[model samples]
Structure formats: C-alpha cells, structure tokens
Target chain A: MLLSPSRLRGLGSRVPPCSSFRPFTAAAAAAASPTSKPQVYLSRSRNPYLNLSVEHHLLQTTPPDSTVLFLYTNRPCVVIGRNQNPWLEVNLPLLSSLTARTKPGDHEPAPTTIDLVRRRSGGGTVFHDPGNVNYSVICPPESFDRDKHAEMVVRALRGLGVPGARVNARHDIVVDVDVDVDVSESDGNHGANTFKISGSAYKLTRLRSLHHGTCLLSSPNLGSIGPLLRSPAEPFIKARGVESVRSPVRNVGVGNGEFEDAVVAEFAKMYGDPDVFCEVGDEAGAVDGVEKGMKELLSRDWIYGQTPLFSFSTYPTEDDPRERPSLPSDFHLSFEARHGQLSKFTFVNASSAGHVDIPSSSSSSPLDGSRIYDVEDWTDALRSYGGTVNSQAETAGRWLNGLFGTGHAKTQLR
Target chain B: MASIARCVRAARPSVLSTISKPIAATSRPVFYRPTQRCFSATPISEVRKYTKDHEWIDLHADNKTAVIGISEYAAEALGDVVYVELPEEGATVAQGDSIGAVESVKSASDINAPVSLRIVQSNVELEEKPAKINRVPEDDAAGGGWLARVEVDEQGLKEFEGLLDLEAYKEFTATLHE
Candidate 1:
C-alpha cells in the first residue's frame, strides 16, 4: 500500500529526488504501511487544503490497528464542518473582505487572504491561523474515546504550566480565567472563568477513528472571529444540519513549538516512541491518492454544493419563527436550497406584484438549477423575472447578494 | 437464505430478551406475500443480520429487498445525533462502500453498506428528527430509525449470508467491551 520510490519520483518531479524528498517519501510510505511501526508527522506546509488532504490520506491508508499522530498549522482559514451550511455558519461578506483588514492598532500588515475550507469532520465552524496548532490522532475504533485525546492535550497544556486547563463535558479543552462578569453571562454557567482553548471534532470509519482539534495559542485575529462566524443571514435561514454551539474562546498562551513538543511527549507516554517522525508538505500532493483527495477538498462542489438542505424566509415561519432583523424593503421573499442549489423561490409579497411563483431548480425559470455560490449578481438573477427589475426585486437582490458574498462591489475593509 | 431466515426466526425471542430497553422490542411484521409459483408455501420470513461495523440489515424473504439501519449498540455509543445524511436513492454500492453518514457528538461517522445494494428509498424523516435513530435504532417500522430500503442482488444475498446472526453479534459486542 505504500507509494513506491519510482512513483514518488515520477509524481514529485518538482521536488529534487536526491534531497529531502527521499526522507519525506520514506516517512509517508512507512506511515502508509500496515506492518510498519506507529508514526508521527509534522507538516511544514501552511496550506489548509494540503494539510487536510494529507490528514485524510493518513486516516485512510494508515494501518488499521496502528495509531498515528499528525501536527500542523494552517496559514489562515475558516473551516466549516462537513454537514454545516456555509451561508448559515459563516459571514460570507466579511470573510471575503478579510484580506484588506488588519488587526486593530497593529503595525504589522494584514495577513494573507483567508481560505475557506469545508473539512470532512463534523462540527461547528472554526477560524485557524499561524498562532493555532491542529493536532490529529488516528487510532483503532475499539480504543476511541471522545475525551481521550482532548485530555491528552490538556495534560500537555498542564505540563506547559497552564494549570487551569481541563477537558470540558463537551470534550473541548478549556482554561479558567478570572474575569469580572455576572455568572449568568458566562458560558456553561460555570461562572465567567471558563474559556475554551481547544475545540475537538472527529471522523469515524469502520476501522479507524480520527480525533482532531485546534488549539488557539496566541491568535491576533481573535477579535475578528466573532464577527466572521456570525452570518447576517442567520436570522433568515432555517438550516437542516448541525448548528454550532457558541463558546467563549481564548489562547492557552504557549508557543507553537513548545506546545507541539509537549503534546508529542504526552503522546509518547501513552504510545511509545514513533518509528518514523518526518515532515510532509506540498510534495505530498505528488502522491496520487493525496493529489486526488486534495483536488476533491479544493473543489467547489465539496465546498459549497455539499451543504445540507436549508430554507430562507424573509418573515418568521413555523419551523424558524424568530423575529427577523429589519430590512430596507418589506418584500416577503422565501426560498429553499438543497445541496446548495436553489430548489424553490417564491415572491410572497412584492409590493404591487401580488404573488409571483418564480422558477427555482425544481421548476422552470431564469434561476433554474442555479448554484447559490455561482450566482455573483442576484439582481441579474431577478432581472429575468417579469423582464424588468422592480423596486422590491432590486432591494431584495442587493441585500441577498451581500449576504451570500456575491456582491459586485467589494467593500474594502481598509 | 432460507436457513438464515429460519435461524433468525428461531432466535427472535432470545434476541428481544438480550437487549436493554427503552429499545422497542417489537419485531417488524413480516407479511407472507405469495410468490407467483409458491402460492402454497408457508409464510415468508425475513432474516436480520449484523455487521461487525455495527450496522444491521433485515433481508426480505424475496431475497431481493432489504432494510438497513445501524444497530442499537452504535446508536447508544454515538450520543445525540444532530443530523443524518441519507444516501442518494438508486445509487448502486458495494458491500463495504460508505452509503451515508451520521453527525453526532461533533463527529461524522460513515455508515457503510452491510451488503451490495441499489438503494430504493431513504428514511427522509431522519433529516428533521435525527434523535429517532437514538430512540429506536433497530426499528424498521414506518417513521422508525431504518436508514434505507435497498434492492439486493445475488451478490448482495451472498454477502448477507456471511453476516453474523443476532446471537453472534451480541457475543461479538461483548468481546469488544471485555
């Protein structure tokens, strides 16, 4: 099952075969072999797509009974759960504008453009940057316990002098910090001291169970996380998938190297010294399976089209009846999306235009079979209705385009 | 297939006695629909088999239909399922292929097919009430926890024959805990 040297050389022509490529490929092959000893890996690449694909490859190809530990850091990204709705969980408008914004009062330039990713694991959305380190453990299903790895990370934190670190009931690692606040306003109602430092999620197959978590160490973008995760369309869309439970989060105040070393030490205590410990990165994309998985992860279909069924109503309905935020126009519009395709759209009240049954993917109309992410201009989509854009249509289209991050005019955050 | 069906029927009472409740103990009613040539044959029976992966399939007497679902053991282990992503109806799959997945406790676990099948219908109601799977995972009744109804081919039947019986499955799970 291991990638042959000849094949690795063929796939990785971009990487010099006589140099570090040999060790990387050897480590990967060792990790992939069923009979090989337990493995540990550290990724030097900051590409979120590559990191996830590499992790997934390890999850699939690693020995069924053997345990694996992978540690890596992504540049900056917003990663959503496999079944979560991007439009409901993420603020698309703000996310699209992040490249132009910098930390408040910081002299350093803004970080690179944030990449949006949809991970195969199921959980709420999370923000990742260089200050955050992600640790993944893949082990046999019989040995899988949700809190096992989280507790290990807590032990690592405690070793690093973070005395308040502990695993919460929800299987996340949190740190208690003294704060002057009312007990009712704090998360988990455990007074105001509890703040999550690591969020855990899992992917389970028949043979292997993979537990991965993000530990916020010293992220400068903590200020932007709250706004980035809060979508303007949250009040309007009633989604049919896992919704995130908001938690107060903070950094554990440790360097990435220090944290990684401590975690590896703790892992060694649990499972003996790794047989192979090496670095992997962009060269991993050279492997055929990894390349394929990377392509799938980077695909538009998996990112947007994999979203579960959801409905959007301008006014409160039976299923999602919360007082909706006020809008510029009083146009009562409703729609439903299945797999990110606009399946149904209705103009319940369009000012003078009584009720108009617009065409969705399920019916015949200008917006037939349109993928929500592909529609860059909602006004253009609505213009085909009645051959002219009315006031109500214009107002709704502009608002929706903004909410869905497809607006023609990108507002510079600078 | 007949021997397996008989074994399942003979073991039904013990199977009911083994599992802890609030697990609905009522077995799905297997009606005897006469085949074109076997009009005088006794009531047709369905055979239920369990996979080591913790899925169960109730193979119809016709040998060409089956209802698939996760076992009660799996449902209890996966606390509070928030969403069930059902497979695409009519998609042909091999025995070990991942047909769909369930999201529970911040984890998404693949639900593999117990046998080769062409999906006919999925339990769409699970999309809205995912907790039903936890409440009655082995129930195949209407509005129950069954994941799909699929068309089983000869290969599928062969695979189904190899799966563990309820008694054997109970023993297998017992060993895992030990």
Candidate 2:
C-alpha cells in the first residue's frame, strides 16, 4: 500500500495495522495495511529469544511503510552478530564457569544461566543484562539510516540529564566523563574520556528495516563484561566475519523506566504518538511465527552453524603472522573450519623424534567433521591421533580445552 | 554485455563511511560455463530484470542460468559493506529465499533469490574484500560484487519475466523517494 504524505495527515489518530487490538494484547499478530500507523510495544518478557522473536514478528508483519518501536530487556546474556564466530568473540569458558557457579555469593550467584545468543543482525558482540534497556525501531527501507534513531536516543539521554551524551562516529551513544587529567594520564591510556553507553545494530529485510541498540543503565555486571567478552583464542584465531571494536562503557545513571519513557517520548516526537501502544509478554510466543523464530534462535544449528568461515593456527602462519605465545609442547597445529566443521587440519608433534605431521586424511581423528560446540575435552580429541600422549601434549590439550570451552557441559538455556 | 543489468544511483549516501572503497576494481569473470544450448529453448528476455527488493538478475546466453546481485542503489544505501555471507553452492532455493546476506553499517540485509534456481558458483572475492561491493556492486565479472551464479529452470524463467525492466525499476524507485 503506497501512502502519500497527504494521506498520512489524519490517520495519526487511528493507525490501521493490528488485525486485533486490546489494551494489553497477549500476542503480536498484526497485519500490514495500506494506511498503517506507528506502533509501540514494551516487552515484559526477560527471555532474549522470546523478545527477539516478537521483534522479528513485528518486522515481518508490520506494514511496509509503518514505523514501529519495541522496547525489551533481557536477562544476563551475551549476544553476538548474525555472522560472527562465537568462539573468537566470546569467552565461552568464562561463560560456562559463571553459569555453573551454584554457591551463594554476596550478590546472588552469578546468573545461573547466561544465554549465548546469535542475533539476526550485524554488528559486534554486546553484553545485555536486565539493567540494560534495548530499544528497536523498524521502518521502511527507504527511510533507514544507521544514526537516525541513535541520535534520537542521544536526545533521550540528554533529556534525562545526561548532558554529555552524544552519538559517536561509530553510531554508538557515548558520554564524555570528566576525569582528573593528571591521574588519568598516569594510567598511560587515558586520552579519551568518552564512555559508550549504548551500542547499535541493524537487520534489514526486503520490506522493513530494524535498528536495535543496548542502553546500559546501572548494570552490576559491568566489571565482569570485560572478562566474559575476552576470548583466550583471540590471539590464535583469524575469523572472517565482523569483529567487535573494544570500547570503554558506562551506565547512563538512570532507571530503566526513566530511559524507556524518555525514549518513547523522543520516538513520539519523530513519528507522532503511537497508534498502538501496549505491553507484550511471553504470550507473544502465541503469535503465528514467533514460536518458530524462537525455536530457530535457540537451535544449535543457528547459533553455531551460521558462523562465517575461519582459520585457527597454534603457531604463526604467513596469513596471520605474529609473535606466538610459548605452548607447553613444540606443537604445530592448524586447521580451517567452515560453518564450525573442521574442513582441513594439520597437527605436528615437534617434541617427538623428528616432527611428524599427521595428515587429517590418514588419521581417524575424532575432531574431523566434529562440531566445535560438541567437543567436551580437547585432550581426548587429540589423544586418539595415535601419538605418544606425553605431558606436553596433555598440557597443550588443557590449554586448548580452556580456550575452546571444553571439559565442561555446554551451558543450559534458561 | 546487453544481458548485464544496471541500476540508478541512490541519491543519499549511507550514514557510515567506515567501509573504504576498494583500491582496485577488477573485472575477472569467474563463473561456470554451460556448454550445451538448446535451439528450441524459450527466448528469454535479453535485458536485465530487477525485483522490487532491489536485486537484479541477468540471464546467461544458455537461458538456463543467471547471475544475481544487489542493485547499485542498494549498495549505496547500505553504505560500506564489511562482509558478505555467501550462500552454499549447489543449493537450490525457491523464489524469495535468501540467497545470501550483506553486512554494511552494522546492518545485515538479506539478498533474496530473484527466482527459483540452483546456485552453481558464488563470488568468493567479496568474502575477502567486501568493499568491492560498494565499488562495483552490479559488475558480474569475476572480481565484481555479483553474489552468485544459479541455473534457472522453467518456472524461474516465468518468474524472471514478471520482474521489472530497468525503466520500470527507475520509476519504482522514484516513487519510493516521493
């Protein structure tokens, strides 16, 4: 349905998109219309998968030209880009350890299950918690701009007295914090005072464009984020997809309710008051396609199989030459993986009498065709290669196990 | 050359300029050649055809295969493409299926199949240097930003016929801006 500027004049009062609308609808089963109105939905579901599914449903079912605003906050989770390599981007071992922590701590035991999600968007990885409010804007393809809504968020932050908040060159919202120049410079890397408060990513289908961002507001896990996002294999792996640009982040010092309300007001300023404003919960799963989308998001295939092709090398190679960290054994190991399956592999034990390279074709090693996610022990995976299982090999395996998040059960989804 | 599709330039530049233009833009035709040509084959249109979604397909001389890529306007609108997730070769996709996806300006946009076809080859160069897409998004040559080469079937030919020609696509985009 094509809408001229003139036709959008009076339709503001009653935008016509949702097939059925109640004050607090259980599901989001809206249909597209010629004369569509702007819609706003605030999610009560803390499940990242469910919230993402509802967002996807809205992106698919909304009118091609209508604008939408969806606000949701998920429990502790590390969300990666659609095409990113999770092993390279996230510290899976750290995630597993935190998820396994059952002991009661000063603060509740570190989130029992921190979900590892691969979102259907493109960008670097981000850490999301209940303290972080996620806002999504979906509009027509022609009207899509990466920074347009991010700027609106900056306005919202400023409205909430974050006067230093502004959209940075990378489209992330950052705040300029004043620091003692003498003391900060003593730390050797204190030139920039800006701390990112929000990070943005986008997904564009044929008909609609969706931009979503994470606004950090009083997250207790801020200190833990650095370790959780840093991977042990970062130095040894060369990946093909997007890599996260590290930035110092801080909270906007506002409540989630205040941020959400300010953002909604800013959104209303841009597209007029929303025709459909309501809060949706897990009941959104009852929508026509939300269940299927949630299932896909939760599947191992989508989480691991969607990774771009990448290569891992223990020693320095010409393609990715750098000073190598000393390994326990003088082992030369390298492999190429596409879609998380080992396609080619080479393992050599230089410590043995005259280093012998184990060609993957001749060796019946279990690592071949093995999904990286399923490997529970790198030592066992390497022990079956018919070589002397020396302490050096065991040590190398233990290091690899830590790097690859092996030797522990995969974290269960919450 | 007539089979090569082209699109109008998008008026607005994308928000992010992080994607630097590729230093070299080379036309290296890297596609599988079909030897057999049927004389009684239906005469497929020689001109390029476009989907409303901003994808374009150019039928090969054999009329059984075509090359697909996003339009120039789409490339400009997408800003600098950082990566392209190429579809697996030898995979058959129905019409409207996502053939691949392109990432630019932190946005992942699907490049849908213009018609039902079996992909035979993909542009691997774009995987290494994605900026080539911003430089030559419509170039079907080997090093060009063309996404894939697919063998079309009878139904694909019918679907192709329904796509908009270059002129109609121009008018359609104009209306969108209006």
Best by DockQ: 2
Instruction: Please give the range of 10 consecutive residues that has the lowest summed lDDT in model 1 chain A.
Output: A405-414
Supply the TM-score for candidate 2.
0.84
CA shift at B94, candidate 2, in angstroms? 3.6
- For model 2, fnat equals 0.51
Docking class of 1: acceptable
Please give, for residues A224-286, the per-residue lDDT of candidate 1 as tens digits: 788889999989999988888888777776888778878877777788766656667678778
Clashing pairs in 2: A376-A407, B28-B142, B29-B142
Model 1 segments beyond 4 Å from truth?
A: A1-36, A100-106, A180-191, A348-365, A387-389, A407-414, B1-44
lDDT of 2 by residue, A196-289 (tens): 8899998877777889999988676676788889998988999888899988877776888778878877887888867777777777677657
Interface RMSD of each: 9.6, 6.8
Q: Which ranges of candidate 2 are over 4 A from the true structure? A: A1-33, A99-111, A181-191, A351-365, A389-393, A407-413, B1-46, B167-178
Report the C-alpha displacement of residue A367, candidate 1, in angstroms: 2.0
